[model samples]
Target: MSASPWLVGPFVDMLVGSGLAYLMTLPLLLIISVRTGFVGWPVLLVTLISILVSVPHYGATLLRVYEERSQRQRYALFAYYLTGILALVFLAGIYSIPIGSALLTLYVSWSPWHIGGQNYGVALTILRRRGVEVTPLVKRLLYVSFVLSFLLALLSIHVENSNHVPASGLQAARIYRVIPVGIPSALVSVVFPVVLMIYVGSVVGAFVGLVRRGVRGWPLVSVVSLVAAQALWFVVPALLFFWSGTDAEGLLPFAAIWISAAHSAQYLWITTHYARRIDPGIRTGTYLGKALLAGAFVTIFPGLLFLPDWLGAPSWAAGLGTLLFAVVNIHHFALDGAIWKLRDGHVARALLRDDPGLAAGKAEASVGLGRWGWRVVWIGGSIALAVTVHEQFERTVTLSGITLRSLDRARDAIARLEWTGRDSDSDHLVLANSYLQAGNPDAAEKEYRESLARRPSAEAVSGLAAVRIQRRDWSGALENYDRAQRLDPDNVDLMIRRSDLLNQLESETPPVDRAAIRDLQRRSIRLLERALDLDRRRVPTIVRLARVYTRSGRRRDAAALIQAALEGLEGLASTERAMLEREKRALSDPRSGSAAGTRAGPVRPGASGARP
Candidate 1:
């Protein structure tokens, strides 16, 4: 009951966070006709994969229906879940992946809230299994978590709304990915084992009914152990030194390798144990174990790629973990659970024995080299994971330009903070600034897509329109600009950019409608006029109108506008003034021509015959 508050709080918060992410795509939702359409593909894929891999447990048992030759029927969800997870695992194993991995990673590695959500689901399942009613505390905490997640989502949305983002540099996203890799190799190896113990301990506690037994007794003792162990991973492990000890920073790789191997062995061992006596009678136990193991390797690993490095994490440890799980599942849990049903409780009796109850009969077990073989497999898997990591970061694309680094830095920063207490709008604003600075149109565009996914904000639409402008995607720019204008009609920059795009498009249309051309010209003038109205000292507004006049065929008006803008540049340096003078001359000269030799064209129908 005491732990209930912590569990429910994060769980509810995660669900609420997910819901906010879901709702934030409201614009995209409107377009797609599904409220959660934007995030659905990845989430559904992960769920499907998780569910699929879980079935082999069932298959293993069903095989014993005693007829290896008989046709077999398997549920579809099992396959789907397995597929999703395996897909992710394959992604982690490679140096690079196909486009699908990129999209899938976003859903799988979205935030800690997602991981917390999964944990909550597991916790709730536990509550149901024991037929325990959630006390008022659990309910209250759940509501709190919901509020927290909602608030975070709101914060994320707010961050995404800002425009002062970096347009080029180390995208913050990529930076997040790199940090964990460098997590002082000394501590790397100890993390998984420590974490694993806690997870397993929690599972055991559940079985022992410590959770049901309330706080302060034998259960509390176990809970205390679990909490202390878990804290060491996140906090500086001052006490674990007695056991895990210290290592030189350079020795981290070997440690990581060892750690990975240990987990792999553990998971596999547990899985096999679970499968062995997992009677053909029931459907869940063994299959669920296998499915979850596969999910660990596939979905979890692959999903990390989408995570910014900070939260991204390495998978060799998880891979090692999967193996470790197999051992515990089969030998420790499954075999034990099955033994529970025996009339005399044979399985429990065997587990209690140090001599290996129901030991593999001497000849059948062939003890020769068996233990060593497992040791080898465990070590090998860890080595493989390390190798995979070595390959993933073999090259760096930054250090070449400030723009790239700035963008990368910002992306990592935003991704790291996305789940804490922010909404999509705020997250997008942060992501947008990074993307904009990075000169990465795709990243910027993604923020826009994210914006459209949730609630449509004037800022988000405008940011998207600006991204469109950078990409030279005039049509999209125009569309987003229009939406932004409707949301914030009096915004000066939006009007100017929108008018500029329209004018540019009008020029490109061959045999364009004279009425439309005239309308655009008038619109351009009005927008410039509006900008000046918003801020009378705006020189850029003056220059922009001059360009409009030139485009519209009024050379005299264009010249006068240029002179006006120049008058405000008295404080500019000599070189700057000279630059401005040359620009003014170029605009005023009829033959000052654009594109090397071509003369400026007439702006509209029936104007001075300079359409050439």
Candidate 2:
């Protein structure tokens, strides 16, 4: 027997460097981490690659907008809508959590559609390049397959919690009330298998036709490989993550990171290609210029948006920044979803101009199987498919039950708090956090107040302060922070939070209040300084204070503070040590601004606070 030939041309030119292709490679790479019980270098490398690739793609899109008047007009409307929505969400969040939570749920639901749609688009693009005509039936099947995969992934949320294991350790925080779309999980379960079976049958039929129609060579191989990759890479993860019960804890992170990276890579490939192709002069000089242009695009949002947080901006500013990010993401999804349509004559002509067959207007051909082939597929595939589907269903239900129970427990905790009165500050604090997650800031405030009344606890005071910050009651929040500081003067975290809010207030306030703004900034600096004085070796606090000093135009103080933070940090991991150096450079560099380009680099949310 001969080993299957490993083809390299398609892997290099079409698949590996692009979105879906990179995504398909995830399962193979993750095997090392899964077996070894730790994520090694490969995971870290891919994550970095994903972040780097993701931004350039956005830049590519923006470059097109800058060059093309039509593109600008098309995108400007979406940009305005996104801006308006973001402002609404920010203002709404100040009043109540429910409205913001509802919008968040809507965005979350739309995300899978956006992601899956992109995958489907990639598949179509691949087929078009191969000149493989897809009938409406085949198109429907492809769409269904991608949609089903997303649905399964959605059902798989909190799979670890289903087994009584909280992966990220915020079980309460995760138990928010998401308004169900009224479709029963059981109904989705029943329909999913049928749709999946049909999708598989259609894919198999298509592959058989490709072979029978003498579609051999790289084109044939590419299409087959893509289908196989989608099945193994996409479908399997969705089913396992959503439907599997065992060892899901080990699998979740790998899937999340890989998917994210793949998505970013894909965006970069398509958008960059589109931009360069559309506007030949966009980067006519050299590859370096193109790279720089893409970098600028990547930097625009990430660079400025995270400034408030980096300077220790209050909860409202951070929340507003978060809302803006979400809005941009949602806009990206919408624009991408609408703009790329291969079936449209204009789009097909524009994107597929190089491929005459793909650009040509021709009727799609339907491919079907012979009776014997259908009989074989139905009989042989039935028993095997049934067993697999049944097992998945059982696992899904068992896992889903765990999440349901967690939600029930959360509700019970809230009810108990209501009945018992705020006797236990700890329990009230827990319930308060839960209420906030559940989108009930009013209840959270009541509980926090009760807790504070029972005891002048720093935690309760801070919690209340946070609620006020979210409500945009800056004075109230600062007053609470002051009280909390009095209660526990040595609390570094509280001081940092206070400083952050103060910095945000100073930056956001009008130029008319120069004296007031200066006073606020000075107060922020003092807060951070006091915290640092209490614990000089605290790297996080030191870095934070450095940020405040830089913001206050005290570059020398900022550089000195960053230098102090970097001391005795040689024992830290390579990444951590490298980050400290970046901070030092950012502070010392004359060109680096407080909120723009900094030595610490772009403040990507969810990254360690070292950047902030």
Candidate 3:
């Protein structure tokens, strides 16, 4: 007798698994991080992320089993996609090593966006398709939760991991931050590709014994390919994102679990997709209850604790190794539950009976191809038309990737206006860069003053300040930094730069005051330290602290601190390592951090961590 399917199976699994890990690591991580001011934001944040991930784990595996037994290639295709995804994610784990561990943590950290953008969408889509119609009110609730969870996730990521975001401008690595394009933090990350190789080499490779050689699956293959398009592009990869970790040694077992759970979605979906044919509402909620509970217990509790540890691990092993091991154990449990349920006539048969398309239309192709052929042609054509229109519109606005757009035209016009006539200080400051680049320093000078006259913006003020720095107008640069600081207290760079200028003027002065030099250095160090506390991974702060230490005759201390900071960077990729190396060199060089770099004049503005 086959065990009946339980809709709550996954949830049960997650609760159980998480409960176990929770009992194990909670006392350790919590005790280490416990303090009055500490918000357990990471815990709530991670739990939220894990639930989104757990739901799909069993969903994917269930889908695979149903597809294989029922000749449902669509579900099989979806399951295969889970394979491709894990392959890519594990590959990235390889790449993050050597650069530094802290730098690479961003690639493996959990994000709320994946839950909203991928998990929620897939889960509801599966449920609705499986005949579990959501009420309008329920739908609204899910939508709101989805958005809120995502926003909160993003905030938590920012609050907890500030180093990944740049100071205030566009950075290529940050801009191209997804997997394959950047690191392996998301579902489509390169890590999955590595895991895929292992699976094929082992699981599917061994499952070759299960293949029926004489079977011809030509139509079935096409069906698989079609449904697979959705699973590959969005559904499975969403699950894959959760599997991304710091490195391969820690990623292997978790990748296995991720693949197993993600495949269950396909199993469940296949049962739903054909429930109209094979069975009707067949113990779906019950079997779902078991699979879901099984998955949830395995996924939820202890895993959340590891998220922070991984995000803050000294080594990749500390962060990801334990998490991966836990994931594998859950995967084994899920695989067993699914097989047992299937053999015992649980949820799968009930679902097949309920879905009209599966039993009533058995002669029809597995993926609804016969009826869906025309629909495909129409949808394909519509997509082509829309794409063509978009291309044409974009082409009209661009020439060699540079748009003859409003911003560019405005810049060009500003240049000609400055060149053709004299401008006020405020206006000149706004257009000084254009004039400078155009070989019109006189015009730039005139505009710089005019721009300053017209209620100086930080951008405009910084512009004039740079011009002063260029021309050795120390007084003017100090004046600009003071004004900018007034406008934006968080201008960390401006504070440091101002300190530098005060030092420069002292050397040119007749009786340079030693007292003033000490004062400026003290002020600069204070500002730098504040900024570092707000964001520990701040490169400028790191460099500035080293310089201050070197100047104060703490040479060995400076070196040790540098090593500690670099330790945070071990798992980073080569590009990231290079960036850190550059910063390290700039800090360590005596010439750059020389006493001359610390001569004093007027004091600079201090640093504050308050939001601008």
Candidate 4:
């Protein structure tokens, strides 16, 4: 029971344990570089990681389950039956958006909890391997910390007012349409900090308890590193949202990519250790080769089934890849749960001990498959890998072109993809955004319609509304915005945009059309008020609501709101602060009448009016 054995080695263990910091921070740094006019090429970074790390990690679980006869028999229900069931579900999703979106939602919603479980299991394994007494009470503290951290991360992701669009090419493959399980922003504002504090307290309390029990050395360092990694993965981001009002939507996509990558690497690290110990003779290279082949097949081969012509589905039936991706991940989560139980005798012996007899039950022979069968698998998987790499490279080029505002490069890559019949709703939406950026409203409108025809999304609908705004089709723009709001009911930005549009219509109405003006003013007031209710501290909403109040002859309410906004102007951007000042001055002038009321012109369509 000496604490002498390390899972891999002390260095590797510690590095993987603390790797989340590097994984998550790298995306943020890349984003900063992009913002500062440097080419970060994040799409390329994500593609490489998926091929090298993420996909293979899923393969590691399959290898663990089916590599040996005993494991296959022990987990037959999961390995054989459940996988078949999920495959059918995947196919169903290919033809039905609601079904596909729900499946995608389940995968995303489960991801944080799955990651938390891994971190919790790893921490306990580290402690037990080092001979630290993991009493029931100690386990409870660690469990609570991890659970709260997961909750914090989950809440930040699905908040009602947050943007739900896929923000990166990595996410674009899986997130067809997020079925948000929204926590209200008001509730998040109140709950996030309280839970974060308790989470921190639990971590500190667990560490102090472990130390009092004489847990020291690499075990202590490793466990502490895992805790710190979780904080970096979850807590710090929540803090940024709750404290500084940074939008979680802007950060969650990158967070999801990095956290998944880091988690996968950790999974591989432990599984490789277990595999080596269990076989005692299998080279790491051989095992990884089999794992990568299995991973590539699982991740990519199914996508071929979803090809536009494969099942005679229409070309717009493009998100079957997303469904397949979700199903694969769900399958991976299931197998991992069943096979990696520490309470199971075989699992414990393999992971916690270095006894020579650990390999006594080694069964490396191919199960039910002959040499040629494996060769077929290897050949098919390699082909799929090549195809996926090429596809992903093109995607990288398209996204990078869009990011850098090289519209021709993006258009060329997109056309090539479409020619290959690889068109997707997200790709169309992205191209539409690029078209809008290039000021080709006609092309933007066409792309947006194409996207909607493929799969109706709030983003696509919003893009169409932006095109309408650019055309000065105020009624049409309002209609599309209303439609977008229906799709994304709790979107604060959409609410503000609708209110702004209403105010614009009101100002342009003939003064003699008092009824029409009144109607517009009332609707604008309601939308702005709703936005304020969703996020009371949103200064722009307050300012807009105040202007509506003034126009509608609620001078006292308008003055009160302007004063409140002015009090908080110090934290706003300089341009925003100056705009608010001007509004306040106009509202205060005695000679100012309807002319001084907020008369927002058609803003650049698709541009957000304020931070949510």
Instruction: Estimate the TM-score of every prediction.
Output: 0.30, 0.48, 0.29, 0.67
**Residue-by-residue lDDT tens digits, candidate 1, 1-612:** 222322223443222211222223333434553433332223223323323433233223322221112211122232234335544554453333232233222322232232233223333433432334555554344334433332222222122221111111111121011111123334534543454454445445443453553534322332333223222211222123223443211212222222222222222332343334333233445444434433333322333333322443322222222322222222222222232221233322222111232334212221332556434433543443343333222212221123545666645544443332122344555566556655666787787676555445677777777676676676777788788889888887777676667666666655446677767777878878888878755555565676666666776787776676578645666665565566587875667531112222222211010011
lDDT of each: 0.40, 0.53, 0.41, 0.74
Q: Which of the predicted structures, 3 or 4, would earn the higher TM-score when compared with the native?
A: 4
Best TM-score among the predictions, by candidate number: 4
Instruction: Show the lowest summed lDDT stretch of 10 residues, model 4.
Output: 163-172
User: For candidate 2, lDDT tens digit of each residue in 1-612?
Assistant: 002122123454366423446545666666766677775334235424533554444444444443344544566665456546665664554334465445444555566667667666766665666566666665675566666656554544322333222111012221122343445556656765776676677677666665665767765655565555455444565465445544443564454445555666566556554544444444533422343344333333332323322433212121333343344455556666656777765455545554334313321111123345334433543432333233234323422333322544544543443331212355556667656555566877887876654445788887777677667676777788788889888988778777766765665677787788778878978887888778765666666667767766787887776676567545666666666677787765677754333222222111011123
TM-score for model 4? 0.67
Query: Which should have the higher lDDT, number 2 or number 4?
Result: 4
Off by over 4 Å in 2: 1-12, 17-24, 39-47, 65-67, 74-79, 90-96, 154-183, 228-234, 246-249, 281-324, 355-612
Model 4 residue 342 lDDT score? 84
Instruction: Give candidate 3 regions above 4 Å deviation.
Output: 1-223, 245-434, 437-461, 479-496, 508-516, 527-612
What is candidate 4's lDDT per residue for 245-292, written digit by digit as tens? 674435443556666678888988888988887887889888887788
Once superposed on the true structure, which residue ranges of model 4 sit more than 4 Å away at CA? Answer: 2-4, 18-41, 154-170, 173-176, 180-198, 238-245, 248-253, 309-318, 369-373, 395-416, 419-421, 425-453, 456-612
**10 residues in a row with least lDDT, candidate 3:** 166-175
- Number of residue pairs clashing in candidate 4, backbone atoms closer than 3 angstroms, sequence gap of 3 or more or interchain: 0
TM-score of candidate 1 against the unseen true structure: 0.30
For model 2, which pairs clash? 156-242, 312-500, 586-599
Determine which window of 10 residues in candidate 1 has minimal summed lDDT. 163-172
